[model samples]
Target: MTHHNDGVTTMPPTAAAAQAHRRTLLKAGLFGAASMAAGLRAPAVRAQAKRFAGVTINGAAFQHSFHAALKSWLPELEDKTGLKVNFELQSFPIYNQRMDLELSTHGSAYDFCNIGTPYAGRWITSGWMTQLDEFAHNANLTAADWEPGDFARGPLAILSDANGHIFGFPWVAGAIVMGIARSDLLEKAKLPIPATLDELVQTCLRTNAPGKTYAFVNDQLHHWEWPPYLMNEGGTIFRQPPTDLMPMLNTPQAIKAAEIYTQLLSSKCAPPGVLSYTDDQSQRMQLAGRANIRTASIDWLVPLAKLKDSKVRSTVRYAPLPKGPGGSFPGVNANGFGIPVGAKNKEAAWTFIQWALSKASFERMALQKAYVTVPRRSIIATPQFKEAMTINGQDVGQLYIDTVDAPGVSDYMKYRNMAVFPQVGEKINIAISQIISGQANAKTALDQAESAAIADIRKAGVKL
Candidate 1:
């Protein structure tokens, strides 16, 4: 065996190598309680060992709970599934660019990869995704412990097409967009927990004490960051499903949402330099007690709940995002595993997916708090996970559930589901940048965005 510096190890395709792999795994402490559970059923898997033996599957590195599992659990995983995986971690943008080229050329560079749910539709439509119906239906390929029905319906739906061709296994179920507030600040300001965006802003403004404290903070660095506000107010970057797709961002509803968003930033209720903050910085300020409220992805709450040095550890509270006049809407996004159409080792890939997402695996990972949102209901309902998901003794699962089930929540990939996402998303980002920089009003910026989006769609040969 030759160990490669790029996180890969090359081994001869022989029984001896397989035995050595098992030995390496045991030394790495892969046989924990979880592996014991997996071990009991290892014999059943051996019945199909020939299918995956000597085959190497490749996957991109994703910043997900699955990543934690991939790093520490693969030996046990390979032990049971008889497949070797080369895990490559990279930024999503760079990974996606490389994947696009590979997928476009039908290259078999990776047998398995992680893909955002928003791009599920585009990949399936482009014939780059392997429809998973057959693999899922195979008993040898699926474990009874991995119940398909246990997965949350919303996430499963988005990862599949209208005809029910699933593109991949749901790997990451992020919490719906929600707000985390400093409970102490809300009490100090004598403000009720806000239920609308306007109320949220007002609460922030009232609670804000200038240099002593800040009121609100959000990540505005990405174009998708503000769509929760837009959707809550009956605005959309594109028309909703079952309707013809077109840009509706320049409308009155969107302009109003943009105005409110900018006002919250410019009013100094939030800290300075918020326009450049990403998810980490935005959440850090609130956890550090620099801000009273932070609106963001639900997943952030998990780390906040566990942070040892967090100033607001006991004071953080989770709730659905504040509503707009139209209603409360949040953003929902998903990350998961997909098999490429060109994959040479799809059987091994399928085997890997099954083992990785099995009920036993999910339960073990959840116990470690590896992922805040496990897509499966059974896993989240487990006593271990229920206890782990609490904040300051409050079971915040209901907040996550309600936000996920909320009607009209923006699917984080709105325009990205179409093939023109790269171009259109960039334009949308530019438009919001103009608004944040005071170079253009909402109407003018969104108008330009709308035109750019249309042109991109036309260039892609996609008819609305």
Candidate 2:
């Protein structure tokens, strides 16, 4: 399978090879058998040797900083808990599917797992997760210190239940609505960098040179990308106050937004293959100088910088999502850590979560991976962290700092079936594609997508 620039590749691993990898990991643990055994059984291990032993958790294949932090922290945890902690990292899709299957069986395959905000509701309702309220209270971990409004009640709240029972701790926190552009290309166009959606679209149209360069591109199929545009137009997918499901796709504001997006393709402002462009494709286009603008997580900056001979290196720029009617609306994405309901070592797991999320640990992790942003408000404000952000070549650290301190947008998830948003998103993409290809009229495509979206929501058993 071809790998997209999204830093993810799908390589079909032979069953035998996979099993061998697992066996290899298991054998590696055996080298420290005495330590591992004592670590597994809490009381038998010595205090110094108890950091982390016999504890196993699973997380998706996150970026370097997170994985590197886990490598550093796991040993410390083993020493503290006298339990051996192991992490099984897999791709996001694989992890999501495996987690769902394991939860269905209430399997003990993992004591802890990293879950996204979207799946939090279903996981908690199904009794697959353990409540972390008591743990928080006991640890004297005040919500005030963590920017709960920005980090919790907003986006991260999707990982909590309706009654205020939190099932997870915020692991990775950052905005998902920043624009990345090739500075070299923008200079060549002699245009000021766009700080608003309108300016961005206009820039794309002005700079587009069909056979040479396209203006902007992205993975149009993902539902998450739509909200920034919606918010920019003073519209929302679902209105608050009972959170009624609004078919924003058919709204005039959405139609307008769709027109702008479709125009990029229809007017030749983007590459001909843009409809099939994934996130990685967007990244690659920007890196290769084939496109001028894209949206990406801050985690991508490091990898982009690492591309030594790339023309865009050191010349790439990032800023918050451009303003629209709502004026610079940005969306946030987060990874959450949760303990399984069936976990045999709840206390140990909680201890690790608490320790890992502490200010000191967060700082250490952020520095090791050169992470530009850390979820903890306190960590970001520190001088050391500011320096680290500078070293990472991020000019928007203050933006992230202010955003995390007072985040405007929140994380969102659809009803349990998950198919609701994606299905609707797909129809919308199809309509946009057709319009771009001149196969269908814009209004007709929007109308068809709106109808399909409402039907899908009903089929998913959502009340709205």
Candidate 3:
């Protein structure tokens, strides 16, 4: 026998015929063992593909910072599940329009869709979403570390039905805290951040400079922006939402809240066309330092410090929505993904959602993209997250955690959980507009709103 560069013994064919014949059986045994290991490794790789390779998860939601951030991480999801994802992120108005239509018709256009906080009640109770308890509890589908308890109770309640079964998981948190866009302006005037409702008004009036910079800026979404002010002034949309289905829009407390809102806007404390401002417009004015104060969700406030284009990065200060006679309240809302009741791919859709809302996913979003809007308390409690979310040495993540926990004491935001709130909130939008424009007095406008809201609630079959 001769050993060559081939690393195997080679022999003259005639001389080593006997030896080669003898080794054939031994070689076959070795080959079988090697093939078995490779076969095991190959199936593991193939198993990933076999799970969901040809499937494409169709989902959609209003364009949000979290959705935008998730786009960059799609490869991780697609790779792990061996599936393609075709999630369409539309503008807020467009998404809402399409979603309402889909819900009404029971269309299966999306495997999963965003459950807007205001619409959660209507969607869940109407049987438009799939119950997630099965997928969440199944050991084969969901890994144990998902920890449903990590979500804030307020947000989870928003997504659960009357029976307390979960249908959606929160991914977008709307923790409405106050942002001082021009702290330099507040400090130059020797004013501290307002601690009470009265101080907020006086501070805005003192800081008013309409020609150069507006003192206050609130977007056209009165349903979202105006409620905090109304609630702070001891007003409520319903007597007690989800329990007492009565409309309380015309109460003394509500009129008082309206008057406060009207005065703040009509005194030239706001921009000339403030009511026409969209969220993007209002946020732009704040980030450009043309607005002194903005009360909005953390999603918008964080941009004041983190965005490269922010003119007020160094000057912005964060605070809870100021206290009033009723109480100190900060608005919290959420948007999360859920499978449509009409969807065909419920299991695969959850596979995406489970990984999407996983602890690992949240950690990457917060640490890499500074997405503080995640409602998972566990992620927010991390030192790494706190460090990443800190801007100019401020623990902004702490403010989010506090705002989330604020309503846990009494569930003040329960009003938003009623299915008819969106309909009722539209009436409020018109009332506030009329009051601000002098088309009607606060009480008259509010009374008209109360009548309209009652009609809406009744139409939705809510008993009064």
Candidate 4:
């Protein structure tokens, strides 16, 4: 018998191994007929119960929250669906590289994967993912609570193509473009919440104290961090459809956004060496009270409310990114559950996906603060969810949701990490680095990047 990604192969299982597997399932309350008697919705369970009993569903997900949720909820999935799930989790960078390799070469290894929206375009174009339109509407398979409409539109739109081929179901619908601040610092400084981009910059400058605390920090290397500011200023990295994308990185709005973004470091408002900070490093500064404002994912900061060793644990507050000159458009990012085209146990994989993303399961994770930006409306409306988003006794879940669902809020994935986008972004990242390092001004750096980006895109000759 060959050992596959899911650990189950075509060869027959030995009696002892089979018996052990059954005992494990039985312990999880997945025994045939007995599960129905336990008051677990029999109708829903009966139709698919043990239908893929001996099947092993392999899964791959990112290491942080997604993997955490999987580890905490896999037992429930096994008990409910009677499908053995074997999951592999890797750190962010490693997972991105590995998943790309697996999808491009060894798609059969994992039945399904938790795919970030940014990579959706790459996977879809490769013809590596199965279209799930029929599986979702199949009444016999989908649970009653799995309403497609329940997903926030921002997330749903990103997961689908122009023709509305939904390649995946949203699992993490978060606005990584929101702002979080230290409430205590703001109060002590006698400053009010910033309502616009200029005000945010001013707030950062005013609150900053050299060698003691800085006012702002963001993950600048990822490239997408520029969107919240750029889009809000009515600028974009590119214009027109992806296939015919025209680089607009050096436009008036873009230059202004870039000037302001890099100014934080140049003006000494952000900590020194901010150019080297990743998402974790940026947030660590805030957690340690070395910075007063952070423009990043709210999902990353919500768990800090419970961190015992953190200085700002009880003082942190969630806020929408300040409105820009044109308007306020926070950038929303998402991750979804996708089935590989070569998955042998796709049916079993779908079953596990349904169970894992169900309302009950989501609520369980929400109580544990596993996710702050929930995908489902039912989970968002729950009291437990409200509690999870509470800061200083204020339930701010609605604020976070509104930010994520805001109009014109750029869905980073909707741009679809096309082959060209990454190329364009790489140039822009270099340009940003040059500006931040004081080696070039915004216009000069971006002008060079823009020309190079256009050339690269044209060279790719990607057709829509």
lDDT of 4 by residue, 138-206 (tens): 989887768766777777666666556777888887675444447777788788877778888887888
Return whichever of 3 and 4 wins on TM-score.
Answer: 3
Model-by-model lDDT, in order?
Answer: 0.72, 0.64, 0.82, 0.74
Better-scoring candidate (lDDT), 3 or 4:
3
lDDT of 1 by residue, 1-464 (tens): 54678978687688888888778767656657568768977765673655555567787745554676666788776675557788887776677777777888888989988766446667767889888878887788776667776777556655676555677767676654555557787887677888888887787777887766678777764455577788778887678542456767788998899877776775468677877888888778877877767667777765676778777777888777788987755666667788899998888888877877778777777776556677778777777777777777777766665555444333433444555555666776788778877899989998888888888877777677
Instruction: Report the lDDT tens digits of candidate 2 across residue range 1-464.
Output: 32479978575468777677668757766857867676676455455454444455543333445765675667766666665666677766677777878877787767777766445555777788888877777635343344333343333554666555677878676565454456666788788888777787888888887777677777654355665676677766654422565566777887777777677565568787787877777777766777767655555543455456555666767667777876655556567788888777777666666666666667777676666557776677778777655523764666665554444333333331132445555666677777777887767888888888888878877776
**lDDT, residue 278, candidate 1:** 80
Report clashes for each candidate as comma-separated counts: 3, 27, 0, 0
Error in Å for residue 410 of model 3 = 7.5
Q: By how many angstroms RMSD does model 3 differ from the true structure?
A: 4.8
Q: What is the lDDT of residue 214 in candidate 2?
A: 75
lDDT of 4 at 155: 73
Write the candidate numbers in order of decreasing lDDT. Answer: 3, 4, 1, 2
Q: Best by TM-score, which number?
A: 3
RMSD of each: 11.7, 14.8, 4.8, 11.4
lDDT tens digits by residue: candidate 3, 435-464: 888899999999899999888888888789
